[model samples]
Target chain A: MLIPHPLLGPRDAQEFTYLGDAALLARPDGMAEGALGAFIDYVYLRDNPAGVHRELWFHEQGDRSWLVVTRNTVTHEIIDAQLARDVALARKGAVA
Target chain B: MRFSGFRVIKEALTGHKGWQPLWRNPDPKPAYDYVIVGGGGHGLATAYYLANTFRKARIAVLEKGWLGSGNIGRNTTIIRSNYGLPGNQPFYEFSMKLWEGLEQEFNFNAMVSQRGILNLIHTDAQRDAYRRRGNAMLFSGADAELLDRDRVRDMCPWLNFDNARFPIKGGLMQRRAGTARHDGVAWGYARGADRAGVDLIQNCEVTGFRIEEGRIRGVETSRGYIAAAKVGVAVAGSTSRVMEKAGLRLPIESHVLQAFVSEGLKPLIPGVITFGAGHFYVSQSDKGGLVFGGDIDGYNSYAQRGNMPVIEDVIEGGMALMPMIGRARLLRVWGGIMDMSMDGSPIIDRTPVEGLYLNAGWCYGGFKATPASGYSFAHLLATDTPHETARHFRLDRFARGHVIDEKGMGAQPNLH
Candidate 1:
């Protein structure tokens, strides 16, 4: 499998280190109200879908930047890849 | 018909006309007292124990496809109970005990061979870790032996002992650990469950659950709706998808694990051997093919196929461990979907949804835990309480902060 990095061209998947779902970027507030429940859900529960998925991958062998790669879990087709920093900023902007 | 030495002689003499089917393909009934999802090894074994040990009636096992067409038949078929944690050691040891009498009681030929298993030690720190692990195994009433370098050489002199990168300093041996016929295990449990009057329904995909005011009434399947008083789900790989029908998420991510088999050759590997410095384990099948595997593909995927990097990594480990294995041409390789949990252990408990129970999060170790998983699941279904051997496998453990983090990898599912 090849992952198309936003910065570099398409590279072999072996060059990247995988951390699971992109939902992991949304770490819950530790000091907020009902923090324990939110932290438990954030740390444990996962929406592990069988179809389309957006996940985090670290370009450990190259630029060391994390990318949010939109891919299909069933077909293994990479739809798009973007910098994780931009995605996180977009999510935070939407929330605000 | 009962199989014996005399029966074999009679079949040899009489043209073999008395052969019978192993199980019955029964249609789903309108209702059953107990309904189990997933007709793989653990599901069938659970049904068998429910009827035999617990004496439960009107039990049914629903299969999405043909029986044993999942991870049950896809594993490399190594069975051992050399666990180091308190929560997991006794449970697996109980499962290992069940494996001892599995074939005889089930009245099938499962080929339960207990030759031995050796985990090679590459460094002094690894040797210390194995020593503690061996002591843990002995404390759990399981067998474990710490062998020195010469002792390991005496057992398997063909190993790369002298001029290697990470020389084998020692090994941890479990004399009663070995392989069994994976397909035979599934068929044996199916036959036993069939004989006990449990319906084994195949090609019946469960689409949704019929939840009535927080209680499970039954499941809506591809065939039709079937009512049941209690429902237990044992689908590990597809747990997240299946449980979503009931409006629940899990602490799991699915990954692909690959296993390979070399062409049949003369017997070389005595039993199972695991490389301490890398992620490779190997065993020789009865057909003389060397069965081997390495770590998962390290990604979230439901596809039952792996990429080339892991395959190359596993072959490299094998070559580093024993250079002679490089000459064996690879015959076939395949992958299985693994339901990796956050804590790297399994969960067997009642769900928040009343009348619903769950047996999942087994990761890649589900094959070896088939018997005890079934027995404990059966006991829970019958008595509505966790079995003594599996009380730590609670679904609420994560929220309660009582997670069984055996590998100490924290909440990273893929890392575990």
Candidate 2:
């Protein structure tokens, strides 16, 4: 399902670097450090393990509200994504 | 006995102690020229103005319950005339003017404390919207002052001006907007209308309308069928049920709006403060209790008791504004049904049925519009044509796409 981004931003694609079938972690910037690492940890906890599939993400450094990145589960290639609070809240509930 | 002042005091005391009925109707007229349904503030004000202004003495205001028992007694009682839309600005301003003169005209104490109303802006979009609304109010000859953070701090010191989550940037303040005793307003108009020879009928519920050849012949009430040349339906929340009896349906949806009051403190809230980011507003009553309310309950419910979610949201907003109020215990909470239209404004015009007029769909802001509603409704009942101030609130405006949507919510509840 296509969900509209609550925040305004440009979409980006990243190659999904899957760690495992239960838990797959893909970095949109391919660089994990400090606050970004903290955000990734939050995302992981928010979107807990499920069957790997297509996922979109967005980097919210500009506004610190949302992020945009897309991923494909079959090939582990991200298509498009953006940072949105509703998405964050939804995914967090799912993962929890 | 050289006691001149004492004699004057004695005479004044005797006049104040004049005989009046405690609850029963002192005088009941079999027929009146104009019969207004719903003896709330709007209905009583209509009767008062009709008897005083139009010289229509044979007027009767029918109330199913005691006067002020409905939403008039249940509202938060915040009065403001800071309307942004053209259709609303003039009418509310007129009502504000009437509020100023109500005490003298009715010989009743309304306790209208003009402590000012401030709408806080938490985001850039909200600030921009308030700026536009301030300009509109100023252009329309209404008082709307824009205040920055420093100014807000100077005005209200208790507010969390530097909170990062919802920083207080600025606000649109109307110094004329304040609150009055809600029950006092109802009783003031009732006593004034009663003194002016208007039959104040209590416990007379209008069950249906007697329509003949598309014109309202009279109303069928629990007491009896009262004949009337004209009838005005000022029943706010129960508008749909009253209209349904006339074989008509309105574009109004009914929902219960809840309000709560906290235990009395020394003095915390100086004036009415509204959170523009959320649907929360608060003012302090004369009894020292903090009176506050949020938006209406989302779903359609005739039940007056509201759920816990709304109460929690309202208190959360309050705590966000004033953390000091966290210690203040909630004393009481109550709910009143609101007949919300598709738009947030009201409908004050003649219905398609002849001799049947409506002054309902006030949403949550009906208390502030009491005087102007009475004035315009009286004018409509006196003459068939609606006053220029109330012409935009026609019943057919919704179907014609001529909606006066002030909040721009269309038909949504959260937008207001």
Candidate 3:
């Protein structure tokens, strides 16, 4: 699969890889609860990729946020991931 | 021929027997036909005009210094007539004409260079304002043209036309506007007046005025007493001090303006360029160096030195206009005190002290107006009537409220 470069062309970044299910797409919305609606819109847009098998994953414990997955065309396997904790927990460690 | 021969023999005898000093005082018959104080450009020019035009040759020009050594030598020489006021337009126009024919009149090469002047407009409002000014110049029979961005680019390709801060939209170009050697202007008039048998007294500082009953009688100089029937003061920066001695207060401020020059470079800036939005103007000297100056040092000080803020502001404006000049190192910077009047225009009129006259208050534009100022001042001194153009610059205008505030900054030292 090929992705068009933002400024240049589709063939500009040839080193790009498409990871299946392992790649988590993260689009940041504002931190307010009202911005969760915008996060839903982001998830909906990513889940509806035009004719591709888009995988979805949920991290309930670690970062306690939603994560989306996609397939890699060059390596035909899972490659990368991301948690939607907007706030990183390791930096803000759980001091119970 | 007999008269000329007799004059020559008398002069020869005077020179031989050291009787020259005795008869040296041309106005030895006591009361002079006319007397002019503050032997600057205007005073000398006034005397020259009195002799040449009115045929009033019994004139004396008293100078504190040796002549051509006052503010006349310390100005950033710029000559232009792009004025916006009705009163100042014709006056500066006359001055421009005089500047055009100065070398011939004085037989002294003032190095008057008609290199043209461009007032770079930055905004639409400024463009409109300069458009009106240019039209005014044209209406008043002067040469002024509005140059668009393309023309500006063609004329000065190095300008930062695309800068975000103050983009250069266009400019007002006056083809006749240029510069003259400042010191040469003073010296030329001095030599001419000296040759015309007018006494150019140097080292004679006017310490006090001998006013008898409410009229000026004579002046008390550092040397001795000199009886002056009619006196004119042409001291620009020190006008207030002289006026005070006459028991009069003026609405003039003594502000110091500084000018800087860059190390010599191959002729890059062919003509004068003044940034309208910014307080900076630049012109190249024949010596391949860039001469530039800006607004005055914002306080009242007689000391001929300026601070760093004005220097930095000027350089910053220059860099914004032409960033390439950032590489050019500054060579020297100097300051000259200006007698800024309530209005930006000069004061050239007879004082209330009967025989006393004035030709001071030339803010920053004195150098360009040297020849015309001198010529008109001479006319006034000889005829005792204000010249047609200089009638607006009366000394009592501030009190009477007929002020010709060209810049609309009344009597404010910082504003003018």
TM of each candidate vs. truth: 0.99, 0.78, 0.75
The TM-score that candidate 3 achieves is 0.75
lDDT of 1 by residue, B50-92 (tens): 9999999999999999999889989999899988999999999
Question: B72 in model 1: Cα distance from truth in Å?
Answer: 0.4
* Residue-level lDDT tens digits of model 3 in B294-350: 888654446677767678888988998889998899999998878776677788888
> Which candidate leads in TM-score?
1
Which pairs clash (backbone N, Cα, C closer than 3 Å) in model 1? Answer: none
lDDT of each: 0.93, 0.76, 0.72
Clashes, model 1: 0
Between prediction 2 and prediction 3, the one with superior lDDT is: 2
Q: Where does model 3 exceed 4 Å of error?
A: A1-96, B1-31
lDDT winner: 1
lDDT (Cα, 0-100) at B355 in candidate 3: 81
List model 2 lDDT by residue over B1-416, tens digit each.
Answer: 11245655876889846445523484445677899999999999999888888778678999998898898899998888899999999889889988998887886678898999999988788889889998888877789998988899898888988777898988889999999988889888888787778888988999999999999889999998898889999998888778888876666656678999988877767899998565678988888899999976554445676766678878888888888889989999998888777778899988878988999889888999999999999988887888888999988776666889997875443245
